[model samples]
Target: MPVVLLRLQEATGSGEGGFTPFSINTGLIFWTIVVFLVLLGLLWRFGWPAILKSVEDRERRIQQQLEEAERARVEAQRLLEEHRRMAATAKAEAQELIAKAKAVAEKERAALLAKAREEYDELLKRARKDIQEEREKAILALRREAVDLSIAAASKLLEAQLDTETNRRLVTEYLATLEQQR
Candidate 1:
């Protein structure tokens, strides 16, 4: 049989006029239109808004996540700057310490040099005083020897015996005559 004959048969209710096209099918057409309208309204009113709202909420969450990530990045940059400042401060402190140490060392060196100079000056002064004292002692010893030699010569020149009292008188008279000649 033809395919149209089978469709017309299914379209009609249980009856003997299934092969005819003029048979009543008003109720089938009406129910098909009513069910199609009901399905279209359900999709428009219920399904579409729920799907769209889900997409909008997902977009909002994604935006919030992006903002949080940006905040984290800015915070990390601030921490990095803080670390750099601390490192620079430490370096400056180290340099200052080194300068202070150098100054202290210089002071110590100057003090030691001054002490050495003072000790050398003291020793030199002592040496000069000792040399002067020795010179005076040497001159006194030479004078004593010259006096003894002069007395022996005078005794030899007398050529005659002399008493103690006469010797003393002669020495006194000679000394007085030498003074008058000068």
Candidate 2:
């Protein structure tokens, strides 16, 4: 390495223009152009195609990922819409069930009220019948009592033992006539 460096320094120093960066050498220029062309050809044959293929693969992968993301977004939106529709349907069904339940309750309440009214009417009719029967019994007892008293008073007033059957018939007929007049 040191020997090569010394030789290069001697060659550059012996040159008429020395090692000016801008000084052009035809041999150096020709060799540099030849080397540049060889390297360019090698890159075109091997390195450039490999680099291009890798870039294309990367771009394809990015495009596929973007497409997949778009598909997933669309699927998510569809699922969200389906969920919203299901929720609305469930809400409507619940409201329908509530209305049906209310209607059933109202019907039950009305039936119960009707039954209660029927029972009340039956009780009132029974009470009226019982009252009428008791009143009839009381009036029969009073009529019997009045008949017995009239017989006793007539017997006392006559001071004689009158035939009881005959007196009773007479008194009953008189009472019947009085009732008819009233």
Candidate 3:
């Protein structure tokens, strides 16, 4: 152990002096080249393929997602257009409904006004007829009363002053005057 330790210390101390700059070193260079080749082959066989496949899968998935998003966007645009069309139709229909309502109301109003005017004219004509009939009946009643009063007055006058012969002559003469006047 002690000898080994002394040799390790001496070798460490003399390393700089024992070293050469370039020795051609065919064996070391060959081993280094073999290790680098093995590592490169391993990377190509496993690591590089896996990495590239993962990259491709990611690109494919992203493309699919972008396509889906585009489809969704188009669908949204279509829905927006449909909603606009429906709104336009509804607005037009509402306007037409309102116009129709106003027209119907005007028509009803005109019909009611015409009916009222007709009824008013009919009532006025009937009332005028009733007034004329009532006036004729009143005149006929007055005439009848005047005739009764004149008959009563003549009976009293003839009874007080005229004889039977004079009464008959007066009645005959009054009847003759009535016939001639008529």
lDDT of each: 0.84, 0.88, 0.88
Clash pairs of candidate 1? none
Model 3 TM:
0.58
Query: How far does residue 9 in candidate 2 sit from its true spot (Å)?
Result: 37
lDDT of 2 at 73: 100
RMSD of each: 9.4, 11.7, 11.5
Q: Arrange candidates, best TM-score first.
A: 3, 2, 1
**Which regions of candidate 3 are displaced past 4 Å?**
1-53, 161-182
Give the C-alpha miss distance for residue 113 in model 2, angstroms: 2.4
For all predicted structures, in order, the TM-scores are 0.42, 0.48, 0.58
Instruction: Tell how far residue 122 is off in model 2, in angstroms.
Output: 1.7
- For model 3, residues 72-175, the per-residue Cα lDDT tens digits are 99999999999999999999999999999999999999999999999999999999999999999999999999999988998888678776787789989999
Sum up the clashes in candidate 3: 0
TM-score, cand. 2 = 0.48
Instruction: Report lDDT (Cα) of residue 3, candidate 3.
Output: 78
Local accuracy of candidate 1 as per-residue lDDT tens digits, 1-182? 55766667676645675435645468878999999999989988998889999999999999999999999999999999999999999999999999999999999999999999998998898888888888888888888878888778877776454656788899899999999999
